[model samples]
Target: MTISKRTLIIYLVSLGAFILAVFYFIKTNELRRALKLSEENRDSIIYALNQRSKKMSELDSLLLTGDYNSALKGYKDQLASSDSSSFDLIQQRIELTKKFIQQSRRVVNVDSVNQDTISMDTLAENTRRPTAEEIRNYDSLSFALRKYQIQLDRLKSQLQKKSYGEYLTFSSKKGNSVHYVGQVQNGKANGHGIALLNTGSRYEGEWKDNLRHGEGKFYWPDGEYYIGEYKDDLRSGVGTYYWPNGEKFVGEWQNDQRSGQGTFYNEKGEIVAKGVWKKDELVRVEEK
Candidate 1:
């Protein structure tokens, strides 16, 4: 097989082109795989972000409700100690308390709940401190409560003055009663506030038209409690309900009923049921 120079050159060129074609095919496949994986990762991040945002919103709303509830309860305790029955004083104090609750909502609403983005520019400001603003709010409520106390004291000193004494009031709570100090608009509980009932029940959270329409916490006298989102006064969203004995339910809710993906844990923290729920019962039993 003695080949001429021209023939050798021709054969070499054909072999080189074939090798290049093979390499190009492999490289193209690799690039496609990389692109497909990147796209999948992006989708996963987006899905995760959406889920996290919703959960964060629910939590933020719940916490705002809690803070307002605590502040109002504290103020109510102060009012009771002063034996202050002054309707005018109570109303004035309520107005002041409303300011703080309003401030808390504003502070909590600004938190963003996005994570998993690889972009260097999206700095995670996910965890935040709600302290200083909360303190200022607490002080505002406290000041108002102290004013109510002083007014009661002044009325006591003026007992001899019938005109001044007549304006003061006193209450010896007659029955197991609960107290609530929060926003009331148009004769209905609206916005954030706390409630303590005579039956030893307590609720603190947002209200709309006198219904618990947002995130809130409800505690029974027995120490059982539900903390989560509410819609139209029903436990209609994601939340956690804990029994006094350490049992708990965590997941979706609809009309005060357990619905959607939820799990029930026994007193010992063992999962009793987990899966899709309907009317408070598990529809699909998930394998542990």
Candidate 2:
């Protein structure tokens, strides 16, 4: 029996409602994911800011106690420990620290202390009052102090560069392993850079708005090289790479693995290794 127009309309309306429900479910899940990521990033930023503020406050206390040396030490420690990804943010904080230090130095009133209390004049002048020509003779000391100032300026400049986009930061440990965390922008590594599992394996390459795109080289601690193309943080396209043990490969790579046609050679410059590599292993080896 044919359904009435009213009944047909009712069925169609119910189907439409079901479709809308599915759409709403997918949209809600996406929104939740976005919210979660936002919260995580917010927390990270807040934590970093709080830590810096606390350190700066400590420095202020040290200055009040007339512990300039200790205050400078604290400042250096914070500068070194700051998150590399937060170059811009940390740079602003560092500059603030510098301003505070400079202001404190100006108001230090070292003129009041005599030879009795650590010799304020000696500390301020760093020596007995020197004749004009004698002060000129202290060029070496002046040069050394200026050199330190230059280094501080350089770090400030680097942090200033971070304000533009995502960048990366890495540090080498005493054990010779590097710790990298950050992101990159345009053709540079921006944001938090990471160096994970230091087998001396490093990823120093170009990033397209934070994704690995274009050419890059992966260097192994043992002196092997993987020079090739990258897409979405994986190896892709044609590349020529050399192994640490004198083995070399020139071929196409896909998804961080060797694929398609390529050549492999041994240390003796002989065609001992030849084949298709899949997931870093040789799939087909053609003997010389």
Prediction 2 global C-alpha lDDT: 0.53
Best by TM-score: 1
Q: Write the per-residue lDDT of candidate 1 for residues 1-288, one digit (tens) a residue.
A: 799999889767765665544444444444444444444454554454354335423433443455656545544543454333334443444444455455345333111222222223432333233345544544554455455445544543333122111111111134443344455566556677655554545667877765678999987756688999999878999999999789999999999999999999999999988899999988898974
Reference-based TM-score, model 2: 0.35
Worst 10 residues of 1 by lDDT: 163-172
| Global lDDT of model 1 | 0.58
Residue-level lDDT of model 2, residues 121-229, one tens digit each, is: 2212121223455344344444544454455445444443432223243333335433332344554454333233344355555655445567776665555668788
Could you tally the backbone clashes for each prediction?
A: 6, 19
Best by lDDT: 1
Instruction: Pull out the clashing pairs in model 1.
Output: 176-198, 177-198, 178-196, 178-197, 178-198, 179-196
Whole-model Cα lDDT of every candidate shown, in order: 0.58, 0.53
